[model samples]
Target: MSRRTLSILALSVICATPTLYAQEAGRIQAGQFDIIPSFESSMAYVGNVAYARDNDPKIYSWRAIFSPELIAATQVDGNPVQFGYRLERGVYFSSTPDDYTDHFLEASGEFELNSRHRVNALAQYEDGHEDRGTGFHWA
Candidate 1:
């Protein structure tokens, strides 16, 4: 196809695509805190499975991932306090050895100090792993 025709086709395809918008979290009311629970699942294709040079053999794989998250927030003495947790699990149908599960934890709090200054604190932790070709490795 000519360059001009290809460009026009690409432009038309882009213009025909639908727009996507983020929806606000639907919060659930608990006894004292508001909770937000969500789940996400996706599939991905990896062009290279191993950290190999172009001269070496290349491997490709596909994987599916599922994640669930929950967040809870409340006010303690009019100060905001929150806690959150999320877990992600990956399943590789062809490359089982590359599958992994990850856990995430978070906590945050805000304290009002007098009428002027306030203190905010946050802590987060994640137990996750890097893909085969990602991150640093010791020689």
Candidate 2:
């Protein structure tokens, strides 16, 4: 089989595992952190890290993720758009290769819908590799 065909076959088998479907029934903790330095400058650094832990009797899963990015661009009145890319990887403490690996590219904007409610829109282009597939999210 070709490389892509073999990859698809493997992904299908891995995702079909029953353990991948079970959900944790107990407590779970999750955390995320991000640092962006001089984002409006010609050079910038972006990084994010997230972690989660779960404990349950029937199902169990934990996950940790890290994404680091860089960008270079020109300024438009101190608010400039940069061309950049990010790399994200994760490991599930109780899952398989098919249950992990989610990487994405994103663009975002925000607006004030009201005094108590604000609206934000984010566009993401996700590349799930052999695990899932490419998709988009608007939120």
Candidate 3:
């Protein structure tokens, strides 16, 4: 095959690949509720584990982070309601006081009283900790 034709074919394949794997934003319907679940994770190499300004000692370690969330929604009396929870965790190879896990809770709902009026509400809470020196210290 000619080089130009091969290049065109490669470009077309690259453009079409994303559509093949794309997920629809619509939630999964289970009974009377809609559910959506998602997860994310990352890793990094830290040359200086502790963000020390000067020279006591430098610790090297690997850091990992993970987060997962679940969302559920339902229609109540022609109104929409949603509830979700997310958890985040971080760990380091070195057992410094920096490793921690956090939890978050969220709730939201919408109501339509009439054809021209609507109401919405949202609430959220978090229980977590910050690493030393980066921000507030708990110890």
lDDT of 3 by residue, 57-116 (tens): 777766666677888888999888999888988766564477889999999999999989
Position 3, candidate 1: lDDT: 69
Point out where model 1 deviates above 4 Å: 1-26, 135-139
lDDT of 2 by residue, 6-25 (tens): 75455445434432111233
What ranking emerges by lDDT with the best candidate at the front? Answer: 1, 3, 2
Measured by C-alpha RMSD in angstroms, how accurate is candidate 2? Answer: 18.0
Q: What TM-score does prediction 3 earn? A: 0.67
Give all TM-scores, in the order shown.
Answer: 0.73, 0.33, 0.67
Worst 10 residues of 2 by lDDT: 39-48
RMSD of each: 9.8, 18.0, 11.3
Clashing pairs in 1: none
Tell me how many residue pairs clash in candidate 3: 0
lDDT of 1: 0.77
Q: Candidate 3 local accuracy as lDDT?
A: 0.73
Q: Name the better of 1 and 2 by TM-score.
A: 1
Better of 1 and 2 by lDDT: 1
- Give the best candidate by lDDT: 1
**Alpha-carbon deviation at 125 in model 2, angstroms:** 2.7
